[model samples]
Target: MYLLIASDLDGTLLLPGDTFGAFTKSVIHSLNRAGHHIVLATGRHQTDVESLLDSQSLPVHLITSNGARISSACGGLALSEELPASVVRTLIEETREDTDLTINLYCQSGWLMNREDRNLRDFSQNPGFQPTICATENLPLSTVQKVFFFQRNKDHQALTRLQARLEQRLGSQISTVFTFAWCLEVMTRDVSKGNALRQLADFLNVPIQACIAFGDGMNDADMLAGVGKGVLMGNAHTELFQALPDAEVIGPCTDEAVAHYLSKHLLQSTALPA
Candidate 1:
């Protein structure tokens, strides 16, 4: 049976250093040729995810900004959930003095950051997908889809504290999830990969039970736990495994595990008792 397959970008589909393995590309192509649906659900801005895929056009749908925004294969925006402008401004003002945390805004147009991280532009064949350096006070809050708190040094403790603080302060006013140990993302209270995935399945008239997804981060938790088949990377965050203990743990992303698994199930023929 055909299925709708979704994958998270950074730690699930892409290799370290934000690169795609050739084997992954081949598998994606084969899956497409076999008529299965492919979707890339990521916390990244759609442009950033597009930068990685370049010209492949593998995904039938793109879930960007941790599900704040979703786009169809024709590059048309389908759904968008924006955070409250007042809340965005309030958080920026409150955290403006925190020097250790690098704040970024995934705006409707492009990525805006308080400081410049030049390494973010590496190897992207798409020259237009660069980060825009901006002062915290001048962020286009109304158009911002996601505000992310990034720990440049990858400090887990700092992230944990920040996560707690945000949850306590915002309560149900906003939603926050850690896309990576170093990156905590805040969005509209309704935003989540799982919610978006279910919406897409319904829009396309497909059953949610026929959808399978893969991920390796806390932001992926909702979708992983909600899908029919949830595959967690062997190298996924410890909390992720503990949270979804029943999920199928596959090999590490470094090994192109998603591709290998798809190859086995999609290419090889199935057998039944005669």
Candidate 2:
């Protein structure tokens, strides 16, 4: 059977300093040798993702901008989902009062933000990162998949309050979550990592029942619920684990538990029953 393995990047796969552990790399190589598929599903844009992979010389499919875009690392095939102009207009109007907050709009062309947001400027300077900034109102709305706010400090109370206000006003037409204390993402009502993973399954001609997903954030919830096997990081949130109690909870992403699990189960054919 063919296996599809998808995971989030920042807090889940790449640790502090944009590092990938030795065991994880070894397991990923083994999985690739076994013909399994590997995918990077992240809140980054295509350019940002491409540059990162290019720097590391790793080849994999990508689901970026919180499931708004899908592309192959081999340099072919791409799809994007964007909210309607009316929705974008409403979002901008809604955030008008919060000048201290920095907002970023993601589209096929690239990332956009108000140039005056110093925090945003700092974030864009991250290694191998580059984003295009254009007028938000003039952006091509059809290619957009998500909007995000980046805060400098890990102020949970501020993030919670901001998310709450957005939810109250947007109601069911929009979905919001904080992937990290510093980042809050808003997606279209129908967009999610699960949806993107399903799309990827179709593109790769694989069954949903044969796919495995790993994550450690609220954004990972739907992906965890939708896949055949959902694995959470041991250090994941209590509520996230409770929400998917039946799913596998491996050790923290940095611990090589995912590698251990794969080595013991999927990597060798002898593990399969006769």
Candidate 3:
């Protein structure tokens, strides 16, 4: 039996509009009661993740900022990784000179953005947290968790080209991945959902094979490949499907596939056959 259930928030656990249905909530509560640990592994910041789960308190371990930060279910920071000051400075300077992308930096204290455009405003509203507007050079780089680049024109091809260029320039100094169509995330090279999950499993004294995960983005590829039973949502990126071809495929997130899968498989069955 799996000891832990880790799920990505945006497109796997929560639906398109960042809403968590009652059915899903109830299932998670049941799982918690049944002695299974529940984890919310997301590309979001800690504040954003907490805001989304507002009022409805559940014991959910958080792996936020695509795994740059980890906190206990009760909201205590357990582990956090920060990008080097030099790296952050260089990246910010390069981004300013090389691209028209709207950039946001997440620190341990709060989110920082240079301007409040329509896209940034919409994103802020969704997360229910406003960013502190500040110059890129003035950001608190010592505690930087993650840097996000948002496409103003929403051109997938252009974003792809930019990502490639940034990766080539940054090389192994940073890790870059796309969490959404118009967004690219960069973090410390050591950070990833897989590494965070492994750390959490160690903290809980649970083996890696006793964990299960679900996700649907390129940022989630490492996590999906690392878990014992990595389930990909039907609406997942084609690249994810191609990369993890052997992973189980479930219905779309809007259909409450995680809830249904849990109900029919993990909850109902005694254990997965050897």
Measured by TM-score, the strongest candidate is: 3
| Per-residue alpha-carbon lDDT of candidate 3 for residues 1-274, written as tens digits (9 for 90 to 100) | 8888899987788876778888899889888988899999998898888888887787799999999999977544488989989888877876775446777899988888876556764454464767888876676778999988888776678778877877888889899888877888899997999999999988888898899899999888999888888999998999899999988899999999998888777778877542
Ranking the candidates on TM-score from highest down gives 3, 1, 2
Would you list the rank order by lDDT, best first?
3, 1, 2
TM-score, every prediction: 0.89, 0.84, 0.92
lDDT for model 1 comes to 0.81
How high is the CA lDDT of each candidate model?
A: 0.81, 0.74, 0.84
**Model 1 / residue 120 / CA error / Å:** 6.1
Cα deviation at 95, candidate 2, in Å, is 1.0
| Candidate 1 clash figure, as a count | 0
- Report the Cα lDDT for residue 223, model 1: 91
Model 2: lDDT of residue 200? 84
Worst 10 residues of 3 by lDDT: 116-125
Best by lDDT: 3
Query: How big is the positional error of residue 137 in model 3, measured in Å on the Cα after superposition?
Result: 3.9
Select the stronger candidate by TM-score from 1 and 2. Answer: 1
